[model samples]
Target: MAISPQELSLHKLPPQNIDAEQAIIGGILIENDAIDKIVGILDQNGEDFYRDAHRKIYKAMLSLSNQNEPIDLVTLSSTLRSGGVLESVGGSSYLAALVESTPTAANIIYYANLVREKSLLRRLINSSTEVVTRCYAGGEKIENLLDDAEKIIFEVAQDKTKRSVYHIKDLIKHTFEAIEELSTREGHLTGVTTGFNRLDDLTSGLQPSDLIVIAGRPSMGKTALALNIAQNSAEAGFPVAIFSLEMSKEQLAQRLLASRAKVDLHRIRSGKLKNEDWPKLTTALGILYESPIFIDDTAAQSILEIKAKARRLTKQHNIKLIIVDYLQLVKGRHDADNREQEISDISRSLKAMAKEFNVPVIALAQLSRMPERRE
Candidate 1:
């Protein structure tokens, strides 16, 4: 007899742990508290189970737990029935057999770990296979292909292959702890300080994950203001990252030195430093060199590139504040037809990047006048 496709698929099953799944289900049906134990250990959802029946049964168990109802065989079966899946989950007979076959609920955690391990392995294999297939196709850009492959492997290795839902109690506990810690700070600057006492007082310093937009007309000192804030934050011991799309790093350094030494910007640019001005410039340079301020003058950078660089800076230098000089110059990930839409996407990506790194991002923007009004 020739083997059918279904039979062939059955022969080549993905990594799984049916015995572990059964133990997990049996523990949940046997004891109401076992669900809590399994949830805590697995931190997973119904889809983590290998068997279809186990998945449905686990979903019912989660529903009961969420509803603050019991998780015994009867309540679970009732929930499954209400959801019109009791028969599909092998009825109550399979559930009963699961409970009888498993010796005890004490080892539910070990069994849950086994199931999670198998699930992770399966995800890795699938991701790797997809990456291999794409590599063989040879049509996409090499850079894009590498990025996709790295992202896939990183997701699996970082345990970010799936979205995680945190319990409310845990979130509340973290909030309370943060509140307590903030209360004990000396200057009452709960977040990273911007070094401006008045501004710090008004905003409680630069709060983490905040997107601060500074908009102004041309020659309005927007870059100057951003650079000042970056310097302040760095001096205050918070590492700062500056993405200068409008200025070169040398120009930025010159401006910083002139600003710190209270010298003329024009004189600094012209290299007309007096003999006495050398000491002041040297002092400013020494302080700035020691401070944790990083500058990247990548012109016309896309949002994705900015995010990638920011992530690297965060991991390498633990940057707490980011300053994008003149955000209007930054490019979007895609070339959209509408200019406003492109700018909107860029702004959204910057905000999202701030949250992802838990840093304060101060993006300077230009106030738009009509294009025809330009000199």
Candidate 2:
């Protein structure tokens, strides 16, 4: 294969620090206690290592630790030997060299961090390479390509984030602080207010990560209730996102206007405004225009589409609540075996979205008439 000098120069060494990798392993080999710190920093495994040999050695150490066995020269060598990769890893002599090369286990955290940083850069490079390749593929949709590009970059970026682990001491302090703050408020709720006194009191004002289902029969104002809640939440200074699969945005706005102004819904819909209703309508319209309530009326939306939009809203607008007009109207996988199964998938997805965004989700549902029929 012929290659240009420029191409060869461009392919310069990928981000890596062999010394750091060896130091981490050596530190862990000398002091097994250090592995605990490195384990959490690395990918919880040996995948963070650039060299195959180092990866394999770290993996063997993890295996020994899992079995409650000590990680020493003898156990590690035996474990590698038993796995038939002892010779491939430069034999037992190379393992000894790693331990001798490292100064002490005290700097294991710093060494591990160095290796982790290099690993992230390498991943970013690989992701960029893939994105470039996909961009030239020519047979894919632009949206798909862009999505793939963003996804690869996002994965590399997201890898650097550590899982949150809140200590009980901190949690208890936070809880006490919250209780004290709440006590000082005359009627303020801990969670976002839904405007209705009884419901707000009963549910603690639509708690975060909750999937609140409002169910009823046909023409029972399920959507009307959701829009009202959205209005209330927006009025309370909380951003609201409503996905009305069954109605248009204009229809939702009309309903909200009528409800807020204490005017007749039918009269507004019929465009028959009485002389006195015009003042109330204009006032309601002005207030509604300023609320941080966003509505999406794209009907027959799949769960994935809804999630993508909701994620965008949460990021761009800091949306606090998500309302799906009705659960049964949501589109799910076409390969689903039955309608019941499809609805089940949508239900679970909505719940997951709520938890993922740490926001409340209100999905309107319809009740079955079998009980009313006395079957």
Candidate 3:
């Protein structure tokens, strides 16, 4: 959810430990070695500092550290001066004062931890305040509002830790173990199977965090292809979710039945099934009924709505895959600058959702005929 105006108003100050922030910077100034120790703790967008001046000071320190320079008073003050903000941040006098306030640099670790804890607390309070303000505003759908609240809380959890930079030595064993697991499986696929033999072999199935786009001209069976993959995956005991902006759930169900039961799609749509088709239709019905294939045929759904619903399915059903029938039909958020910008947001949100749920997202798209005209 976007931050509300209510959150920005100076109604009250958020949670902060000024002493801790001061201690961290003071320790780093006193002992250049302390910068190395606290980088992992205060390395986030400087949100860890509640005071604006402290944030600026820490950013300059980070810059010096990045340049392989020491983080002492001489270097930090000079860097701030070069950036033209030394006077605004209280200058050399302030830097010396921070160092004076520090008893010793040995307790830098404890001070850093204190600052981080206060930062997390501040974020929580601000988020909860936003939710409460929205509740009073009282225009959103109850379900959507609830979903928004849940998403905010979950995002706070995702943002809890600092940046991650892993060494390859640690990653190699994890990769090798994954390979071992794949080798023991009969099909030898490392990701969710799309039920296409050649495609699965080439791409090793649809890996988690993959954003697969199926593009074509209209009436090119793009929706059919996606539905088949969803059907096959659900049949294999992997929960699947389908978001259809171009068709109704009943229509999709009929298509799935016609494809799975090997009956004529036109005949099924026209209610012209022959007597022999009954058994095949009945068997397909049982299979599909038993399989865990969920569909939301909401047209013109906003990207946020899609994400909220998808997150819910991921939590409740542990859905292994998500399929958006067509991308151009989904609406972007209302706050977009223009159509082009909205489309960009929609694409990125889809990619982020795939990573968030650790599942494959297949979005269907239509290619403009400009290429054909050019050719």
State in Å the error of residue 218, model 1: 0.9
Runs of candidate 3 exceeding 4 Å displacement: 1-187, 335-337, 370-375
TM-score: model 3 vs. ground truth: 0.51
Q: The CA-based lDDT of model 3 is what? A: 0.78
Q: In model 3, which range of ten residues has the least summed lDDT?
A: 175-184
lDDT computed for candidate 1: 0.75
Tell how far residue 20 is off in model 1, in angstroms.
Answer: 38
RMSD of 3: 13.8
Q: Which ten residues in a row have the lowest lDDT in candidate 1?
A: 175-184
> Model 1, range 117-153, lDDT digits (tens) per residue?
8888878777877777788778999999899889988
Q: Give one digit per residue, the lDDT tens place, for model 2 in 228-286.
A: 88888887778888888888666776688789789998998888889999777666665
Report clashes for each candidate as comma-separated counts.
Answer: 0, 0, 0
* Every candidate's CA RMSD: 13.5, 13.4, 13.8
Off by over 4 Å in 2: 1-187
